[model samples]
Target chain A: MTEEIIIAGFGGQGVLSLGKILAYSGIMQDQEVSWMPSYGPEMRGGTANVTVILSDDRINSPVLNEFDTAIILNQQSMDKFESMVKPGGLLIYDPNGISHHPERKDIKIATIEGAKEASELNNKKTFNMVIMGAFLKIHPIVLMENVHKGLEKSLPQRHHHMIPLNEKAIKVGMKKVKVIHDYKKLVAEE
Target chain B: MEEVKLMKGNEAMAEAAIRAGVDAYFGYPITPQSEVIEYLMHEEPFKRTGMVVLQAESELAAINMVYGAAACGKKAMTSSSSPGISLKLEGISYMAGAELPCLIANVMRGGPGLGTIQPGQSDYFQAVKGGGHGDYNLIVLAPSTVQEMADFVDLGFDLAFKYRNPVMILSDGAIGQMMEKVILPEQKERLSNEEIIKHYGNWATTGKPESRESNIITSLDLKPELQEIHNQHLQNKFKTAEKNEVRYEQIQCEDADYILVAYGTSARISQKVVQLGREKGLKIGLLRPITLWPFPKKIISELADHAKGFLSVEMSAGQMVEDVLLAVEGKVPVAHFGRMGGMIASPSEVLDAVEKEINKI
Candidate 1:
């Protein structure tokens, strides 16, 4: 099985790092993975994104136009990537700066109040971890044990003290995510 | 066994150079490839492996340093992007003429001049066809994965030393920036001056011993006849490389009706095209040229006999297509599909080009 994901947000929003963690988690499970980021001037205080692909078999291309899942953290990213999701795919977004909500009827849509939740948790840096928790709640591509190990590998040793807090933020995200539309249920009704 | 780690292509190459017993690294920083030198500086291979890593003031100075080190029969390397590589053309030509063995990497970006700092394969002509003046050829290796970016360092150095010719690792920004799992090689010690004398003492200018004739390394020949002979000798070396060093990968080619030919990142996209076409019951295959200089003409010529048509996909305006045409020799229709100025062609786009070629055939 292969899963292609695009995580996009503002430059400092941990968009690239989120994707890197997912890729590392995939590796923890002994899966083949690739992480490619949109680099250069565009990544300096501008919209930054990364494409991560995890597969049981050899991965052919790291660059893709369509994705199975799109984790959008900002309004600009949501607007740009909302339609790029494949039919019956999943799109998870943060409702913080979204002026226009996603209106697609062919894909599954989920929302996480990541900014509000991070503020409530009193740690704005855990915003990305919260979104990742919501994603894993909907689709458990990698096991939680693997995700914990991945965090250990990705973060510096000094940051290890915050692992429990990050874990708490993820659980908060998993509990707070709201499903706006379910494409599978819609198709079943049809 | 060495451990596996997820590494960027440029960083992997730097680590590989340190482990490959490279004597010195002289390079200037450029976008999309700065990580190579940055990793080297951070690792401080001089402290770890006794290898010298220096940041040159310019690409010209870096390549000249390579030339100087190589003249002493040492393993030296330098890397740059398109514009910086352009600045090193004169030194590269001199290295070829002087029969110096060194490694150069061009993490290509879009260009005629000062192109965008994004991934591109537009340097195909400049790399495979010799960018500098006069008669010369560089053994060009095209790597599509981060692992290859590391493996090719050792391979490049070995081939350079075998033929006493400069070799180039031709990669693009996409591969340079992407991260993937790589199994790094074990560290090897750098060759000492005494070892260099023992192995390459015949021609190396290692402080010419009193017992032998003085060794000289120069690209100049005052007599036109001697220069002609030198040029012919270089030509013969290129021919030997062409015969023995062509490398390529063929995927799903047997019983296929159409074939896609590409290298580097374009090859990655073409692989998806092949898979998508096969899903639609189209018999499509992909041929990736690992060595751009040798061109893999024999394989392409053989495949042309049975294949309905060929699509040459690249990031340039159809430079490699000329070579493909030469290989096919009008046996089947060959078309070109490309994106220029750092733009990437998607899988669907490549499939559309393949469908068009098949229809024409």
Candidate 2:
């Protein structure tokens, strides 16, 4: 399956890091993956969005038109990417901030108060991990073990200590999903 | 034979420099060209084999460092894109005036100013014709593949020392960022510096205490006859460069009626276009110039005999076409297709351009 994910937020909101984790996860799943970001001045401030495309075959184009999934960590990110999300695709947003639901009926909007949950867990910074947890719970793109391996490859050597906390945040965020994509059932028809 | 792995243009260039047994590298980071520094930095080439590496404050500083190393008769190089290269032209001119041997890699980008970070081959004239002010030429090598990108690093240093001229690796974004398979040479084939000094040390400014009377490195000679004679000497060296440095790749030129002249990234895109043209039974082929200065002029001028029309494809606003006109010498009518300020010409667009020429031809 072809999956396109655009993770966007303010520069320090860990948007780039999250996109890297997703890309590494794709690589772990034996998928052809590419990650491109806004560079130069656009990267200094404002919104920093990275487009990641993972496919079973070769990726001809790295640019994304409509994302299959979008993980918006802030209000500005939600405003920037909500309309760009594909119909029936998932929108994982910070529950404490984003308010407007996309008027689209086909797509599922999972606003799981991620920042608040992370904050309640005494760690607001792990909001990215919360979003990733929601992603793991929502999509069967890869198993939790694969995501862990992806994180291991993507994280900096200095940030190895953050791994278990990220895992904990992912599990806590996964708890709120209350939904899982049944890939096995869907595979029967395809 | 060496085993080739898929590698990007920038990675290949750095790899080539390392494999070429480069003794010193002084460079500043710039878009498309930054990865060369990045690869060398992480690979810690200096620590691995006791090579010299310096990340300078500016492109000016970097080129001067290359000059210092090259003056010592050591294989040295610096890499930067267009704007950074413009900053180094002053040093390049000095190096040429002193006749110090060094290598420079220009992974060119779009610019008359700080244009864009995309690929462009507009620096053709600047590199080949000598961007620096002087009656001299730096042997410019244009590579279109990962293999050539690496191979030329060694070749550039060899040619630079052999002719006592600066050698350039004329590469662009396509080769800088794109990944291709390349077979690497056996490390045993590389030369040690003691062997290099054996070749170039005679003219190097090592020291005055033990050797000759004095070692002077300067571009100044106010005397008319003296400077005139120096200019004539440089001209002769350039003539030697012209004779020895012509390198190019020809694809299906024997039977093709139409020719596509491009290099670096534009050349890779042209390869795909040539394949499509051949599939449609259009007699189209590519002539990729591997060396821009010694410019495969003889090869291209000869191909003009069989070619019905020549289309010069570039990433700049039709800069290299002047060189094509020079080479073809009006044997066949020449047309140009290009995009400036970091825009890349797609393969389909190239095919469309070739079709437009075919319609008129």
Scored by DockQ, the top model is 1
Q: Which ten residues in a row have the lowest lDDT in candidate 2 chain B?
A: B185-194
DockQ of all predictions against the true structure, Cα-based: 0.84, 0.08
Q: In model 2, which regions exceed 4 Å deviation?
A: A1-190, B1-7, B180-194, B209-211
Candidate that would win on lDDT = 1
TM-score, predicted candidate 1 vs. hidden true structure: 0.98
lDDT of 1 by residue, B1-361 (tens): 6677788999999999999999999999999999999999999999998999999999999999999999999999999999999999999999999999999999999887998999988999999899998899999999999999999999999899888899999999999999998889988788887887675646777786789998889999989999999999999999999999999999999988899999999999999998999999999999999999988999999999999888999999999999999999999999999999999898988898888878876
Chain A TM-scores, candidates in order: 0.97, 0.85
Q: Write the per-residue lDDT of candidate 2 for residues B1-361, one digit (tens) a residue.
A: 4453445668877877776778889999999789889999988887766677789999999999988887777778999999999999999999999998888998888888988887788898899888999788888888876667888888888788888888888888656765444567555233455565576666676555664566677789999899999889988988887886677888778898999998877786787788779999998989988887887888888899988889999887887888899889989989999988877776778889999988997
In candidate 1, which residue pairs get closer than 3 Å at backbone N, Cα or C atoms, i.e. clash?
none
lDDT of 2 at B292: 78
Per-residue lDDT value at B188 in model 2: 26
TM-scores for all candidates: the values are 0.98, 0.70
**lDDT (C-alpha) at residue B297 in model 1:** 98
Output DockQ, candidate 1: 0.84
